[model samples]
Target: MSKSNRNLFFSLYWLFFLVGISTVLVGQVLPILARRFSISDSESGYFFIAHFAGSLSGIFLYNYQAQKSNFIRTILLGICASATGILLLNADSQVICTIGFFLNGICAGANIPAVNMLVAKLSSLRVSSSLQVLNFFWGVGAISSQPFFHALSSDGSVLLPTVLLAGAYLIAFVFIYSHRLEEKTEESSRVNRASFWTVWRNPIAWITALFNFAHVGLESGIGGWLTTYSERFAKEGLISATPVFFVFFVLGRAIAPAIIDFFDDNSFIFLSLLVLLVGLVVIVFSSSYVGLICGAGICGIGTSAIFPANMARFAKIFYPDASKHATPIFVMGSFGGAITTYSIGYLSDYFNSLKVGIFVLFANTLILIALQMLVLLGLQFPKKDKT
Candidate 1:
């Protein structure tokens, strides 16, 4: 890459990093927020759903608008939306927080695709690797948010994190806008009008979506509930338990990309599912904080690489023009996380056992493994090639 290209790539990479960190801030704070607001576990899960709903909306909206505008403009809009959402969150009212989360999700939904698309456009043939690099930054963000939130430990400390998150988005907006790249108008418009539906109609797209759905569902579902699960065993109260979840969650995300580079996507995913099953079992049955922390860490490591690898596979199978179509599938997979998060919340509420709700996650992981097997069988189980 040229100097300018490399700069743009890193800029976009860090943009994704900031967004990933900001998104997990809620996960870090959820337990405390639950107590502060006196909400049920299920109700706390709604915060995630609200964010997911906004993200889902942003995917379609950005897709529609991308056809009419430049990438820079689309990203700017996304940043503005995210910044506004963070400001709303600073109000510290539950209703406002919910609304803010939704808006932030929308901003994130649009921003992610736009940034990935931008990266894809800039990268050489190794688009998968490029995307993985972007995800590494995402892991950094996810991991970094833990200490960031933990540092704000005081009365009304929540406002500090929200303010910092807002500042990150604001900085991202300025960086993206200031470093505008020029593109051929005709080429940009041509890509925007490509048949996203045709790509969606592919059988592989469905398989990818299904796997992604399961992958994201399990990852986010467990992540959303991890703090609460920790609280069940902790003596330091909910606030302290929150960081334990963050530690494992971010560690897994941060480590996944490098590992995926070494393993085939199919095998990586299959192995991840198996690890997740074991972790869930350990989490549910264990009595001590040590067991819980170990389980959460294992779960994080197992689930971390699934998304990037699945996405890379989707990109390879559906390529040349897979991005426009595949991007929506990716976003929809994220929406699946929202669905599972909500489902687990409801199940936890109904059964009065977050442990039972966790079993639902284990089941989803198994379903994903089964689906991947079927897909591989259909492909005649291609021999693994060393990258």
Candidate 2:
């Protein structure tokens, strides 16, 4: 709405946007990492584990000290952490790569929630619209990561992608560092801060957190396995498959703002889940490249709205506590990604079938739907919250 708001938007956008690269890019390139390091799919879980550890720490620590620090100061610190991690990714040693992923996750752990808090706090007409815009930028960033890496891998070089990623963070650092915003007034600060205990006690908070666990895990699981799926079963590279699904995912997010007012939250959830389930079903059944890519697009479209739309609602429901609640949501979320990614790899290896690995996503989506049903029924949930 003002000069400061524009700057915050740019800063927040890149903060989420850049990490989109890691979210999907790492999955697409996992095969390379495994071969280069002589690790198994199960061993690959270590990267996810390292990242999860970092992210879990980030969410908890930020919640503990959020009130004591301003958004800019905390975000800059995260950017530095993330940049260092990204740089470490270039090393040849297996241990170094694992460390790099762990540190890179640490950056996400700190930066993602902090940026989310900043965006939610924007003095806007509707926080829902603001959040949709946030997720849209995230979608765009996610799209960039897949195709960009594929192109580099085609040339048998990841050097440019690494440099580009470093440059993205550097630009973000400079812009975010230089920009200043109006300070929060004392009264607003008191209203905005919520202690962890208060947030943890809310059942809706836990359900919502669990929902994020399923949703993020499903997305990450799909990304981690899709390339392998394409290579082993179909005839294609990771790049071809990722963009098809991600483009639809981007479309879904871009259109989310327009549809929010059109459907009630419950109705929207049903519609999205239905589409998502259909996509996953197609993926499991498809034997051809065309079928797999099509299924990916459907899955992307299905996933597009879940995270952003649900996040917008969380801000509405939790408000002052949203910042605090974000911790558990993401903590469980990291668990979801970590466990699901690791499980799929382990299970796939156990079964000697990539198809078996994908069933994990199928089971996960079903669980997410059941959780949302609980939310809609108002089971163990308060009808109204005091902010």
Candidate 3:
């Protein structure tokens, strides 16, 4: 990579780093936010729903506009939107905070795909490996998030962090907006007119999208609820256990490039899911704080490679149609986050045990494992067209 290319990559990394923090911010602070607003666990699910719903909408927006606009332009817009969301998120009102989360989701929805697509386009030769490296920075952000929150607010108020995050986005916006992005190639510039149905008609496309739905649901459910789960189950310092999970999560991603190279995409995902299942089993069955922490770390490592591997697989399998398929796949991811995160809270409220809620993750993981098995079997069962 040339100096310019390196600069762009770092910028993208920084953006994802910010994205990492935003991704888990609600989950990390869910308890505090609940207390502040005097809301129950089920009510709190609204936050996740609003945020992810906005994210789904944003993905749709990006899908429509990506061909019409440049990646840098979409990215800049997302950065600005994220900053605005953070500022709103810092507000005292719960309604405003919900709106802020929605905007934040929009930012994430727009930028996540935009950044990933940009990297894939730029590093066409090594989509999987490059995405692995790119997502490693996301893990860095996630692992640092709890510590970052603690460092800024001794009382657990999100005000300081949100303000600082908003400021950071402002600075990044100014810099990235002014930088001269590389010119788009003819391939990048071509319009993809395939309708959503066209993409959905492909069995590979729906399966891949559903796989992401399950994968994200599992990942986000764990990240979002682990803190509360610790507080309820193991009498350990909630903060301590939550970050341990993310720490291993980061380490897993950092090593994914090397680890994944040994196996093909389906093989890697299958193996990763098995590890994830083990971790989930440990978490659900374990009684002690040590066991909880250990299970979290194991789960993190297990989950590290699944998303990137699947993304790389999608790119390779879809090739030129990858962009066409990107929207629904990503939308399902956000949708999964919305439904699963909310469902966790709802189930906890219904069953009156966080552990029961967590069973949802366990179930989703099994579904993912089964889905990957089907993919491995080389199923090409596309949806039938109308007669």
Worst 10 contiguous positions by lDDT, candidate 1: 378-387
Each prediction's whole-model lDDT (CA)? 0.71, 0.75, 0.81
lDDT of 1 by residue, 180-212 (tens): 655433344544455666677777778887887
TM-score of every model?
A: 0.88, 0.91, 0.93
Q: Order candidates by lDDT, high to low.
A: 3, 2, 1
Best by TM-score: 3
What's the candidate order when arranged by decreasing TM-score? 3, 2, 1
* The best candidate in terms of lDDT: 3
C-alpha RMSD of each candidate structure in angstroms: 3.0, 3.1, 4.5
Candidate 3 overall lDDT versus native = 0.81
Overall local distance difference test of candidate 1: 0.71
Candidate 1 regions exceeding 4 Å error are 66-69, 184-194, 237-262, 380-387
